[model samples]
Target chain A: MIGLRALATGDALPQVKPEVMRMYNMRFCPFAQRTRMVLLYKEIPHEVVNVNLRRKPKWLFERNPFGLVPVLEYNNEIVYESSICDDYLDELYVERPLYPKDPHRKAHCRVVMAKYDKMVPSFYKLIKPDENLRLQAKETISEEMKSLEIELGDGAFFGGPQPNMIDFHVYPWFERLTALKSIVEFDILQENNLHRLQLWQKRIEKLTCVKETMQPKEWHLEFFIGLANKNPQYDIGLPQSKV
Target chain B: MIGLRALATGDALPQVKPEVMRMYNMRFCPFAQRTRMVLLYKEIPHEVVNVNLRRKPKWLFERNPFGLVPVLEYNNEIVYESSICDDYLDELYVERPLYPKDPHRKAHCRVVMAKYDKMVPSFYKLIKPDENLRLQAKETISEEMKSLEIELGDGAFFGGPQPNMIDFHVYPWFERLTALKSIVEFDILQENNLHRLQLWQKRIEKLTCVKETMQPKEWHLEFFIGLANKNPQYDIGLPQSKV
Candidate 1:
């Protein structure tokens, strides 16, 4: 099911039992990856329905009028927005408890998450065709990375002994930084004084959930390259027969 | 405390007992208003320290590096971002729960909040100096108001008969629409087919929390006009003696 071609505008919605939870996802989307990571980390039994974002199916709009992915359908109810999805899952499951128990600590994680949200546009800018824009984005991202390094001070992860929701919330974009660098000839992590962040990335990458949910850098490269060329191959890694 | 002049750069930070929670705020900022509304709704005893966004106090950055308002300081721990502050307050003080008790219902509220967040840029555009941009923003906001009208179908409030956290989250922006309309000859709530939303605005405005937290429409008008003219009077409503 994971390897199936993305469902496009005219494609039929797949049948899933009402008991099972499903996620409307796009394989290359960082926002969707955050939800996918949480699902895996929490060991929630679910199905993935990859959508063609450029030519989204009509049913997708029914689930979320905004037509964005990381939309979770559970027990016939819909929830969208990556952070909201992750928070909902965490609250419902309550097994591992991704957020800190203390209200102040949880708020701190959220504050950092808010900062990361603001920095995302710069990450997207790195993939833009304009060299000057990409350079400016790199500068902004580098400055943000320094802030992240400070936030990560003396801890293996943002969650401190373990990877927390904030860690997963940010990891997808960090995971994509490599693909972005390959496309833009800039290495934000390596070239900047971000040693702590580099180590944090390595630590997060070693997690099982990260391993399971991640698409390879090469796949990201191919997808972004297609996006830059104005013809995104949403079914990039699917088998030829599946496509 | 609410009527104090906004403290600008180099101004001394006021002394508040560590036991008393404080919010770094701008009186006219709608984002700050959300936090202020939540605090009042929850009846969390807090002091407000208004800031001059035009020349923010140096110490404001110590609380929130972004130097934006609605930064909550409780027990010496800082939390910024308006939604984060509201959520932190809701979690810390559970009584009179603004959010629905059911997880799915809470998630639904969040979904609506996300839609509201996306529509805000267009609302801001209504105050822009350019007539064409204002016209375009009016069209976009009118379309979004219709969607809100549908969302409010059959319910007196988004929270269904009572305002919820999502109601407070979106109310500050809606409250400013009238002020926006006064500046630009466009009336999103009045001109569009949004009777439900128009009524929702009235219901929200009548709430005690909203009344206590909100500035008058005239204050919003004067503040916005100053903003449009590049000379924001953050301390407009304050007494001349205080200024």
Candidate 2:
């Protein structure tokens, strides 16, 4: 334990050079993927422990009372909220910056983050079908995609010239739409004027860093498709790999 | 906007000279209120602008694409995400610091913050009058309340001996439970393990700072009651303060 005084005055970000952060995570969680994306971007080496939500590791329960994953364990500084972890990493590592340095740009970045978080709850509603939520998700995805189109405009990634923290934070979830396009029906790309979104998706996944960090796992994609297809009301089209 | 370099290098905390933060807020939003609670706790003052969500101010919309209340504009820095704003203020403000200085305690603080953000979505589902959802809300709320109790166990606030950022973040939403108790059939206060939770709620509210920053207005409570009434499937009893 240290006071603000104990922390080195000249140094910012966590100055204590410790081993790589011990990451508590799983492959399927997009939230966890967001953190992993940061690690890949920062080039921060860390031990990754995958946990089965069904039978969570005891250490997980000990470290995380809430019983959730994607917890980062550094020397002593542990951070939560995948996006917060991303921000913290950006602060600590300046070599490859992710967040925008402008306030309006930062707030714009948050809107994209909000778009991703908003998708989860309604998206889960489709795990079991009901007209209102299915219709609601359709409308939301449509509007969100449209919003993303304008937000992205002519930008290569969500970030203008290069992928930044916002790109890594939101792109993985959008990748799910690509994987399960056929399983759920919505003209999100169409209605949202987001043809650019699909293009950007391809660009992000093909990044040398991103490609090095990951490979296509057909099972995970298939699983979401299976989940989407199980519902009676959804007539999501067959899978489309825009990427 | 300040660079990550400026953000880290600033002798922000514990320095007598305070950094001013401009806050766009709404008194009634539990999310927005969390920021005010932290500002008051840290003893930092800022210019506050009230935003109407339905009719969002153009400045806010232009400034914050998400346009959510409690947008903190500091030293040419614009930070969104309520939890971000809370932690940022603590990091930047010079007096009455509310964050735990210890790394482990900081991790624990984040665990609690992450839990709050994660639980909020599901809990919002409770407003809809669906049998499964209502049950889930109660179950989820009860579960979180239990966690809060253990976290607070014989301690005053989330950070022992002080009502830190997470405590302020959680309390305003839990206060809504008080309003909902009037409508829902469950007695969260009377539950077996919630006795400590009930005690903590009262203890935190007694803080002069919290009391000043948050108060239950008759209509706002009615607004929540009205929100709860949106789902008509289940029977609810709303005690109308004005009528």
Candidate 3:
């Protein structure tokens, strides 16, 4: 129930209740998924308004000038950027805090997220048409994975006992690891005997919040491969009329 | 006295007191200047350990694996990244909060920072050796300036009455704007008649914290231009001792 569906061009905007929150999202966007995971994990009362990114509505632009998902609208105020949205929500609804209560630990959490962020470009590079660039990106990804292994360093989660911002922030990239391996002929996660990283991935996969929000491996592979090939109709066949 | 000078390969590391803080910094790094400004703003007693970036010390790498400057060592715990360090310090010393108290306003402040964050690459593009790329960057910067002008929109500061994280986060770029303009023959601030932005620049420049931390405009111009020219001796003139 927490996962994505589709949106079409002619679909009417969802009715917003005074108490409920709404998020403008794309079905296949990893950035949007990060917010979705946070919302579902917190069990917040929210509606997802999936936008057909290929034909984004004018209202979507009105909501977020950058036209990015998942922009959260709460109490008639809108906020965007996945990290910012998540941070705002965590601060507003502080029951199960996504960040550490200790200031030093929280600061260290941000550094961990930043360290993982360096690998993002290489993940995108896996889909490029240039094989040379793809190979170079593979090397970069491998190097970055080694760094991640060191950071993990026998920990169950980057969030320590439970998943926090760092866990959720970086998990989206791993969701596509299967697709990246299939398309690029190698998997950085599998290669270096990254024992801690592999175990960390498994731990993330077993989480109920992740289970509800994540699409299957095949689904991710197909979706991303379609994106890599620049396919236009890749997101069709969902219940568009309802979304 | 909270400003930068030069450091050389053999410079001795500043002796750290039992309780005082120490910051590893570079004379001309805009990123490092951000943390320096924050330290000065908060009136925190800290010693500056100038790192000869051309020849970073082994201890520097031990402090931070990424070997970046603006590393803060407080209570024997090391923290790096300008924003993270500033946020940690602000949270630790709560007398003057860097972000707004209201969640909505804080989120808006983050968006303001993110918007300015997108313009950074274009600023660097002004220094690109390729004329066509430089021209393209100029256009991008102009467009981004129009966006900033819209964001500022009659406010004294991005956070309303006073400067906040957004102001400090984006001010370092303006500190080097004169250099960027002198080298590129264009001024994004002056070109669009960005009155608010220009006023904001003057206001930030006048802040005692900024005044204490900022290098002379001529110094910034010479250093950045030297960097753009790939000059290795730009950071020379300090005693070549053990850092």
Q: Model 1, range A1-243, lDDT digits (tens) per residue?
A: 452678999988888567888998998999999999899999999989999989999999998988999999988889999999999999889899999999999999999999888989998788776889988988888888888889899899988898888899888988898766665776787887688888998899998889987888899999988888888889877778878
Clashing pairs in 3: B10-B241, B10-B242, B11-B241, B11-B242
lDDT of 2 by residue, B90-159 (tens): 6566477777665456556766777767778776776677889888877877777777777787877667
All candidates: CA RMSD in angstroms?
Answer: 2.1, 12.1, 3.4
What is the total number of backbone clashes in candidate 3? 4
lDDT of 3 by residue, A1-243 (tens): 332444555666676665778888876678888898889888888887777777767778877877778899888888999988999988888877899888878888887777667778887888888999888888987887787788677678877787888878988888887655666777677788887888899888898878877777667777776776777443544567633
For model 3, the superposed segments whose C-alpha errors exceed 4 Å read A1-5, A8-18, A128-132, A153-155, A179-187, A232-243, B1-18, B129-132, B179-187, B232-243
Q: Comparing to the true complex, what docking class would candidate 2 get?
A: incorrect
Ranking by TM-score: 1, 3, 2
TM-score of chain A of each: 0.96, 0.77, 0.90
**Which candidate leads in TM-score?**
1
**Stretches of model 1 off by over 4 angstroms after superposition:** B129-131
Error of 1 at B88 (Å): 0.6
Poorest stretch of ten by lDDT in candidate 3 chain B: B234-243
User: Model 1 reproduces what portion of true contacts?
Assistant: 0.90
Candidate 1, CAPRI quality class derived from DockQ: high
| Candidates ranked, most accurate by DockQ first | 1, 3, 2
